[model samples]
Target: MESNDELVDGMIKAMERLKSGDPALNTLASYLYKADHRLYEYLDKLKIYTELEKPTPQQTQDAGKLLEKIVFLLFKGLEGLQSVKSFQSAGPQYDLLVSGDDIGWKVVCKTLYLEWENRDIVIEAKATKSPLEDKQFARLCSIMEHNLRGAGLGIFVTLNGASGFPKRDSTRQRAVSDCRLRQIIFHARTNKIIVVLDKEDLFQLTKNGTLIEILIRKIRDLSELSGLPTTPAEQFQEIDLPTHLKMLYHSNG
Candidate 1:
């Protein structure tokens, strides 16, 4: 199992690779907002874990100090970011209109694609906790129909638990069906919405322990499946427990 530093480094490497020319750049470029939130949360968690009285003094101090350094570097990187959507489009003034008639909402998505070959892809990234709301989904479907000629795709990417539908259950199935019906009514042209959940994916941070190891493994699989290059994704540095954190672990000594 890898550690926290490995995970952050992997994500950074993946971002660099994506920038170098990952087709999914379409989706990856807009993930900075969620990434920022995750990193920030990690910093907070480390502080709390260190301050807990149950841990030995050494462990507490080591984890806290290491995490503090990580936090500092993250903020430094964040400060350099122009906006959450800075990497979305090639230049300023680029616009992809997403509007719906029945939904009474409009959004100009960053890095939106109206058509890809014979299909259209309307992409939206939102920070809301409820991406499945009727109005919101309706707006997305309507926008696809009105703007993309109904034959494209609707992609909603959200942070935390916002973008995914609930797991299937007898009672929940009814609601899901209703939502599908409403989506059809609004879309009238296209029939699919691809939702991506960042929070769901965040499990990799803890489960794999190192961000890079998990990401590298996932990217390797994806590359094999999609025929994308895995070199850059595999080139990241290994995770190291920061000096402060190691010190905390040895504090009792």
Candidate 2:
């Protein structure tokens, strides 16, 4: 039985190899993907165990913290990322703060791009079974609006997705309404953006490595829909993952 530390070490080594442009990037990525799958399995098992044992609230909170750490590690090597830090002192702070260069924003020529040099991204992680509530979104909006650090983006990550919204809405009317509210809040602050990344998005990122681009596209789309100026999606950089790995992962489908 491989320990979690061992698995993480393997992932780190694989990520390093991937960054080095090794020919075996596909193999390494596949291995890392499997490792991530195993991680989720373990988390699921833990959840079952906790259900049976009736874990204390503190124990449950600890489990949530572990999940938060996992997400922080997964985002370590994203392009333009300068640093990722988990907040320790526990009074009214986001779960994670991922600081990075605003290169993508600049590429899009969004308003106030020059002032957005250091892109402080606040991430709120919800590892519980419950979906994210409207209050959480409201809180995130407040933080982004008032925080002196000047965050340009807020990401709300959840295991189940947003509360009161169906996961697969055929009409997309709910999604559009949510995006409109987000756009209103973000633009009211001028140049700020907020997005929700559910478990599906996380899985897609692990499987395809295009999450960053997707996030940028979401921001651009929101800006355009709101009548704000933004660069065309074609102008953004092309960041295709290794073809072999993508095929390998999608082979079953």
Candidate 3:
């Protein structure tokens, strides 16, 4: 079996080769893609399944941390990208930070709500079994409201779609109302917007080099929905991994 060091070194080399515009970029992309797959598998083996009948709080928190780490690793080698786990700013510690030239991401995982805080792009991650909820939508609005300077965006990522928990119909309806309210508030206050990424979005990101495009498209969709003007071309910038190095990093099972 390859040691951890060996695996990391190989991934680093593959990333470098891909960045260097090597003619064999596909081969290097494959290597990095497989590396991502292996990481996902390793995470799965950690047995942090949220579908458990009864999971301890510690287990849930640990699983969330591992998920954050996996996201950090996914964008680690993209050009002009830098990522940090458990990043601490002035207010509170974030689960992950993905920052570069023109963009910044402050991520939180497994949390019920995020208070009105700093202005970095906010991401809320949920477990595969959990669904996006109205409370979470309210939290995203709070974060967007705090971003008065119009430099931040709110993203909610979940392994499933909207929740059908407790009261399925009521929960779903409340979530929709919250989303509409968020759009109005965002349009009136800041240039920021909120969007959701479900399992399909994650799958596309891993299967293809579409992270940047996915983000930009979502932002555009939000802008349209809110009746706000379209985002400028300059506002959208590509990060670490280029599109040409298309790769797959998600697990099949």
The C-alpha TM-scores of every prediction are: 0.31, 0.56, 0.51
- Best-fitting candidate, measured by lDDT? 2
Candidate 2's displacement at residue 197, Å, is 0.7
- lDDT digits (tens) for residues 106-205 of candidate 3: 1111011112233344566666466676676776676546522332556666555444222212221223244555554665575555666654455444
What C-alpha lDDT do the candidate models reach, one value each? 0.37, 0.53, 0.46
List candidate 2 segments past 4 Å from native: 1-63, 88-91, 101-115, 163-166, 174-183, 224-253
Ranking by TM-score: 2, 3, 1
Q: Which ten residues in a row have the lowest lDDT in candidate 2?
A: 105-114
Whole-model lDDT for model 1 versus the true structure? 0.37
Give the per-residue lDDT of model 2 (tens digit) for 26-100: 233323222244445545544453354556787778767766755675555343456677655444666787655
Instruction: Choose 1 or 2, whichever is better by TM-score.
Output: 2
Q: What is residue 112's positional error in candidate 3, in angstroms? A: 27
Q: Which pairs of residues have clashing backbones in candidate 3?
A: 78-240, 78-241, 79-240
TM-score of 3: 0.51
Clashes of 1: 12
